[model samples]
Target: MLNKILLVCLLFSAGSSLTCKWMDRDFKQYSESALALLKTMKTNSTNSIDDIEVDDAVAFPNELYKHASKESREERLSFVAHVLDEIYALFEENQTRASWPENTVDDFLDIISQQANGVRRCAGKQTTNHHKKNHRKMSLYFKRLSRHVLEHMDYSADAWEFVREEVRIHLHKVHLLASS
Candidate 1:
């Protein structure tokens, strides 16, 4: 009886370990795909356009990255997933105004959604309430940014460019987190 119990425990541990490894690989692949899509959207123009500035009241959370570094893998994944969700909503809301190729925009949004879904699966949570304050701040930041892009930007291209840059920066941070 003792032998049987030990055997079962060992098998379960091994299975759990394998599942974790598989999920990590899947998450990494999704993150990489999202980054690649962002890269393809890069523009060569360095000309400065008077773009809508980020609101100080809901500025990008630079400190969140530091906190994320210390967080558990699932916590970090959850935060990134939430951020991706917001980005998807932002782009989807303004899709009609973007001058980028229709397929490219669609693919970008699709990849972001997939990445968010992959992380949420690994974390086993649809949304996290751990850093509730930070999450709320982020949500507001994106909302204000989107409004600015829509109403303040001089042209549709400027708005799309701003969104692209912000997405690329956030995705790059997520990629670094995954690598770590």
Candidate 2:
């Protein structure tokens, strides 16, 4: 509990201390779209499952794949598995609390599984054929996950704000890379 508090404090301090404007415009655009979807989920509105926008999701995985030269094939696969595992855990933990239709929940899990399979299939390959499609899945998964968190998690206001800011930072970095 104390650690979470400290982490949130650190994130808040770090975010406030940074005056970087290089990625502001791109970050604003990216965060706004994602945040809009998240807000719909928060209100339990009827949003299309296809409303998941993952346009900025490809940058990190592409970066990882490109920089895998120093690492062995096994290492790269392990990294991908680790990421998938976290997503899986988050899905399992929050699936019940989301209160979406049963079909929607099941469909979301199917998408998650497909994403995992795609990562496994391309782990050590030169090309990521599922890059764009998997990114869309990732974005959808995040919306559902955030909805669960917003509705069920016991995070304080500051902590929730910190999470949003963390996402903003991540999207900003992804945008910077994608733009360049």
Candidate 3:
């Protein structure tokens, strides 16, 4: 009986492991495609000074990414989902001001939404305060970025460039999380 139980457990674990690998492959493809689209958009855009002078300090939450990296797989998936959600909101809010092709923007957003859904599915419905603090910080960062882009940047090429770089960095972080 003991040997039988052990064998069954081993088989179940192996099956789940294979399932996870398949899911990861899908996640990786989504992330890669998003990154590639961003790259193409950036390349086609006019060259402008990448630096923007802002009165306030708006920074990416590196600490959040670092902490999430050390947590369990579920936690990492949750963080990526949350970040993608926030990015989607930001992009939706500012899409009107972007000079990029509308179809490209739509495709990018669609991919992001799909990727977020996949991550959330893998993360399950468990909610924890483990990432609440960093999540708030990230929310604030996007809010500030929105304000800057709308009020100050307007239709400036530099503003769009700044936005692209910030978004690219966030997507790169998501890719890293998914890869791990």
Candidate 1 per-residue lDDT, tens place, 29-55, comes to 767777787677765555443344655
Report the lDDT of model 1 for residue 54: 51
Q: What is the lDDT for 89 in model 1?
A: 87
C-alpha TM-scores of all predictions: 0.78, 0.32, 0.81
Evaluation by TM-score, superior candidate among 1 and 2 = 1
| The best candidate in terms of TM-score | 3
Q: 1-180 in candidate 3: lDDT tens per residue?
A: 999999999998886676566455798888788988887777345555344676555666787789888878877888888899988887776556566787887899999999888787777646578567767777888788878664577756567667778899999998897668
Residue 84 error for model 2, in Å?
Answer: 2.1
Taking all chains together, the TM-score of candidate 1 against the true structure is 0.78
Ranking by lDDT: 3, 1, 2
Pairs of residues at least 3 apart in sequence or in different chains that clash in candidate 2: none
TM-score winner between candidates 1 and 3: 3
Ranking under TM-score, best-scoring first? 3, 1, 2
Candidate 3 or 1, higher lDDT? 3
TM-score of 3: 0.81
lDDT of 2 at 104: 44
For model 3, the local distance difference test gives 0.77
